[model samples]
Target: MARQPTSGHEGEAPQKLRTSRQVYDQIRWDPRLDPAAFVIGYETRESGAEEIGLPRFDPEGDIPWHRIRYIRQGTTTVWDRRSRVDLLEGKRSAPAPSAQCGLDARPVHRSALALIPPREAWAPIEAIRQAHDRHVERWMPHINLLYGFLPEAAFAEARGAIAAALRDVAPFEVTLDDVRRFQHRAGATVWLHPRSEPPGALEALQARLEALFPRCSEQSTVSAGGFTPHLSIAQLRGEDGEDGEALVAEWRRMLPITFQARAIHLLSRRGDEAFAIRHAVPLGEPSPEGGDR
Candidate 1:
């Protein structure tokens, strides 16, 4: 659960609350905007009140303020700059009515590339994912090949680039042989390791995509040099205790899950919203002489 912003009145004015450090770090700040200059506010009903906060803005500051028209769902908050522009330009005199917030909140689209396993594979994986991932219901089970923020304006160009990069790629098979754990500062993440020799077809596909659109790989924490092709099963927090380790061991025992990968899907969501498949590009059929790679 996410911490809701605290609200209080300074004299007759309502003060906007600063998000918690954890939530603040999760914010996908636009590269064009300065983090120091950005302040998030909720919308207030009162007209002609202070709706915007400046650099001196503080959640605990003694200042009279109104709300900004924005919606928060779960741990994610999203706001459109156009609303602020409208207010400033006198095109709008008051904040728009607040809408429902959370995962169910209206989606804003963004894009990524992933390899989706068939339903037979997804069924069991989804069960394990739900038990482990905090945001399991919001996302599907898939191997993320390339994930980046592709805005609608650049969607066509990005789609074209991805399609071209995968033009010669043939469909391949993946076998999840065992559970592997990667230790992180947060905790341990358990994943399904594909049974492939070093620098296999999956690696080759990722490399080709990275070469085509180098910028798409820029924001990823796992760099191309250290890329490991696997389907994430669960992200165990530090507090999950010995029970978490037991679960990982149990999953490892259920090894060698295999599936055929035929198409690369382009998935996207706005902010931290739920992802949906936007495009499916099929991998090239194997040549008669080569057979399935």
Candidate 2:
């Protein structure tokens, strides 16, 4: 018996299998390298009817996954997805690159209240952060006490309200004694987890802030769960496999650094602009008994 061949249409020509390859050059930053940095690239394809010429180095209009041989970030090959495919139906058009990763030249201003770590504790963490991506250094290590898209008009009122709410709270010590990993769909973040005895000061401060700024707490990602105090050390792409785990382990070994939280900072940024300290609200003075109450 003769076996019949499968066909989607009776008169259609057989789809020819082809190999497509593209190389993006001069890439300044790879998303895999720094989740914070913008994703940018150019592409060129080989063995296609569209055009066979010099490689295109223009900013990527879309991500040509089916045709991309590999994507290079800095001097590293960050991604590779290439395979043989039928080209008779023509190659699939690449979907437009996401606007989320696009670089915005204009600053977008915003404001928030946070507790930034002192330089003594931040220098080592900053080193690890920059090792992952130099750009991560732009953001200081901090625990957000309250953050939201606050307009300039409301900034003064918010700062005053926060100061009044925290006025009764005395300075306290926060011990970052362990390294933890915060996994997310976008990427994994290495963090310095703060530990304290029962009736934790960090939790207490967060509770007071939430009570004072219910709207901000409602809009926050960290507010859902009981407040977790931690400082971001580095952002990493999980695709890096053991490298990411190894980095987390290295940081874990450097546990137990303590610092006093003397003041809470009111930080602001315009739109996507870099954050700047707008006000520093000092905690209550220590009692005459030689200790904070």
Q: Which candidate ranks first by TM-score, i.e. highest?
A: 1
Across residues 200-277, which tens digit of lDDT does each residue of candidate 1 receive?
Answer: 888788778767655445223333345677787888866778988899888877777888877777676656578777
Clashing pairs in 2: 108-270, 108-271, 108-272, 109-269, 109-270, 109-271, 110-269
Model 2 scores what on Cα lDDT? 0.53
Alpha carbon deviation, residue 102, candidate 1 (Å): 29
6-70 per-residue lDDT for model 2 (tens digits)? 34688876543332222221121122222212122224342222211112211211235454443
> TM-score per candidate, in order?
0.57, 0.56
Question: How many residue pairs collide in each prediction?
Answer: 3, 7
Candidate 2, after superposition: displacement of residue 260 in Å? 0.1
**After superposing candidate 2, which stretches have Cα over 4 Å from the reference?**
1-109, 133-138, 197-199, 218-224, 271-273, 285-293
**Model 2 weakest lDDT span, ten residues long:** 52-61
Q: Give the residue spans of candidate 1 off by over 4 A.
A: 1-110, 197-199, 219-225, 270-273, 285-293
